[model samples]
Target: MTIETDRLRDLVAAELGRARDRTTLLTESVDEGDLIRQHSPLMSPLVWDLAHVGNQEELWLVRDVGGREPVRRDIDELYDAFKHPRRDRPQLPLLGPGEARRYVATVRDKALDVLSRSRLDGTPLVDQGFAFGMIVQHEQQHDETMLATHQLRTGAPVLEAPPPPAPAVPVTGEALIPAGPFTMGTSTEPWALDNERPAHQVIVPAFHIDRALVTNGQYAAFIDDGGYDDPRWWSEAGWAHRQSAGLVAPQHWSRDGDGWASTSFGRTQRIVADEPVVHVCFHEAAAYAAWAGKRLPTEAEWEKAARLDPATGRSRRFPWGDDPPAAEHANLGQRHLRPAPAGAYPMGVSPWGVHQLIGDVWEWTSTDFHGYPGFAPFPYREYSEVFFGPEYKVLRGGSFGTDRSACRGTFRNWDYPIRRQIFSGFRCARDA
Candidate 1:
């Protein structure tokens, strides 16, 4: 094997290990009761996620890539996510906490062995280690989901992380992205999901987008001005959901004297004025944009702001550049429990001076989930093809809980428009 091949293998192995560390942290933070319990109808039991990741790794790496025999063929059906829904997972026969831990550990041991000898440049699946990258991303994505379950679980705070750094510079207002064409997707990103493939040109007219995300204090103004109660500020569907759900503020927020407080991971704290507001659904974000005399950027517009480099007339791999994320770049990889104050991570800003565009929150966009112009599902259709429709809205960037292995400039995330349980927020944009 060449030196380059050795380095690539080492990098892939390190990423896999990083994802497992996070998964362990999320699953081991609580007792067996917490792991077995389904905290919300919207999420699966922690144990389900714990075992599902291992099942996927076994299917993709141990069996498919390495040509090894099945580790636990019987449990494949039990962990098939589409075969069972989140609300019904707790009722199904699932591995206990200890059993799940042992199962995943065994799978990881075998997977690492496969990595030690597998060719890194043969078929497309093995070339550049795409299959291994996919498995690492799958596990990290589930780690994020498990973290959300912890938030919904009823108990004392079981997670801990240091606060994000204070803002390094005062940030306010918006930045103008000059009207032009920029690449919107990636044909070259080895691990990019199918939906973000077939890099294509997107022409966006001149627009103004918030330099920073909508802060808690900014969102509070919308609530104060009857943003939720006024149907005029909401879409027909948003207003209907607002009424039916009886939403008065962003999820986890409550009235506190003349201010507001929010509970996170079982700990309640006074709302910080400059911190980005989170736990908001797409409807809430759109309505808030309307109330502010702006609108949520279309998916194209959001991508232009995040990836386009004005000087070079090209799109980079991240807001900052093609380099992988670092601690000083964005608040990702569950390194922090909450978003940093606006204006933090000056080094993370896009070429257009858009702050916090790549992390802290999954910024909602106006576009529905869809395939790129020349999209084709690589290995399976269930990953992206099944979800391409109006039923799911596109969310760009990532969030504090997102892992770097699963995120990039072209990465796309989608969910029901009414979902607020996930770590989500938005920045308003306007035509210039």
Candidate 2:
């Protein structure tokens, strides 16, 4: 094989291993009981995620790419995400924690073997090692999900990470993005998912966005101002859902005497005013924006702030540059359980001076989820196509729990507007 092919194989192997390591850490940190138990109706049992990642690896890499026999054909239906919802996953005959670990390990061994021998330049799935990249990203996505499960589990904190560093430079106020058209999607991001395809141009009016994310202290003021009780600050649907859900503060937060505290990963601590507020649904973000006389940015505006460099008139792969994410760039890959202070990653700021745009929180956007113009689904429709519509809202920027493998400037994540269990937050935008 050529040197380039050898390098591709090694890179693919490393990423696959990286993703699996995180999966192992998330599952093995707790006992078998925690592995099988569903912490909430919103997420699957940890073991289900474990074995499901393996099943996907086997189907895509070992069987489809390598043309090998099925590893466990009968169990495919058991791990099918659409067939079995999170609420019902606990009752499924899932592989035990140990069994799931062994299954994934075995699959990884064979998948690597296939990668060592397979050509990386043929077929759409294998081209540029997209299938391998997809599998790596798939596992990392589940790792993030498993990390969320860890956060939801009731017990002493079984997982730990030192706090993210304090802000390097003082970041306050807003940054202005001039009005113009910039590339909105990607045709060049080799591993980009189908939704962020067919690079498109979006013309955005001039706007100013928060230099940093809204912090806990800022959100606290909203709550104190009766942001929830007032319907005028919320949309009709948002107000209805707010009343039904009995909305108070962000999830896991409670009034601590005259102050406020939050429970995270089974430990209760006082809320840090500087940390970007998380666990907030889209409705809460929108309400907070409305109260502040602003609005959640449309996805295009958010992208322009993150990717466009006015001097070069080129869109970058990340806020910092084309280089992959680094520890200093943003809080990612579960490195720290929570986000750093709002202006923490100065080195990671965009050319437009937007801080922490690539991580910290999945910033909510005002735009409803939809396919870009000239979009086409590749591999499968289930990944991005089926979910397209007004019912789901788009979220940009990966959060603290998001992995670099699955996140980019063009990456898109969507969920129900009312769902808050996932790591989410927002920065307000206003017309220039």
Candidate 3:
């Protein structure tokens, strides 16, 4: 289906608006001190994220695609993510929240002007609003980062969204994904990131994956069985990290009387047993899998369960179908501050009846972050190419913090094995 110039422009504009709205919502509630404070060394300050969002938009949309002069040219180095490390961001001469907001607003105005006049076809960057889409996705990605910063910030709750609907009925057992070759990734998704490009065929052996994400209640059982205490379940490196960090349970979790409570945003509440476990690093997930006599699904296995429709023998844009995400489809776009109960969103299940494959928590896969057979970086190499190695592990699907534009079956998320501050989780898979 060819996208017309007007439709493409509208889509770009709408996505840009949504990205800005989410960014504002995430940052505006906090005071200036909160915005400038470095909540965690691993993350940039909120104000830095705020300005960086605009700086990136300006780079891709106004400067690169529009072929226009730079606005606030000198600040480029200050906001250059690759140039400056997260820990050093607090020492830079950063823009205040008011100035940062104005800068982004000005950049957005100019970008929209470019969108209105520029042709949507010619080069890969301009075709299908690729640059525009990239900018929107970049901003949304920062929005997610800001949300993570909020999670790390020590203060009263500054964000809130109503809980998602309860599951109609719990999906009690694993779903059997048939053994076969299915199309993985995509060569056709217009807005797909570079890593998810060039669709390919993958043959997965028969396997049983959980119908829903592993719940807090289930993980608590692992804890009760001394999953963390015993070194047998953890890898050598994982055990070392666990001991060094003194990790007792998932980050932000603690014993509240006889039960457990978790801190979200800033409020501490009793752990919801039915909800998918969040904040567990790859090690924890791997350990939990070991405790249960299961294993983390390979990236290919996760993609097959998510995108491949056995009947059609093709990969859909999302798990449910080729439709954009809806409220009932998944918990995404910061619509909820927490993951809904596992087994919810039956409508979001894949063709093979794998539930909640698209949202709730980004499920960790037992695969290293690597490129495909025909992998080639477009626009820039730093986005995905720089990080393809054994140092990072792959994560599939999206979490509650993910924007719909950035969430898809083929979208690849990876991180160092030890990092767990993001909204990450896992499910167990076993051979059939």
Full-model lDDT for every candidate: 0.93, 0.93, 0.90
lDDT of 2 by residue, 1-432 (tens): 789888888899999988988888898899999889999999999999999999999999999999999889889999999999899999988999888888888998899989988999869999989999999999999998888888889987899898899889998999999999999889988899899998988899999999999999999999998888999999999999999999999999999997799998988999999999999999999999999999999999999999998999899999999999999899998889998997789889999888999888899999999889998998899999999999999999999999999999999999999999989999999999
Candidate 1 vs 3: which has more lDDT:
1
RMSDs, each prediction? 0.8, 0.8, 1.4
Clashing pairs in 3: none
What digit string (tens of lDDT, one per residue) describes model 1 on residues 277-314? 99999999999999889999999999998898888887
- Displacement of residue 79 (Cα, Å) in model 1 is 0.6
Stretches > 4 Å off in candidate 1: none
Q: In model 3, where is the ten-residue run with the lowest total lDDT?
A: 1-10
* Regions of model 3 farther than 4 Å from truth: 1-3
**What global local distance difference test value does model 2 have?**
0.93
Model 1, residue 51: C-alpha shift (Å):
0.3
lDDT for residue 118 in candidate 1, whole number 0-100: 98
**Would you estimate the TM-scores of all the predictions?**
0.99, 0.99, 0.98
Query: How many clashes (backbone N, Cα, C below 3 Å) per candidate?
Result: 0, 0, 0
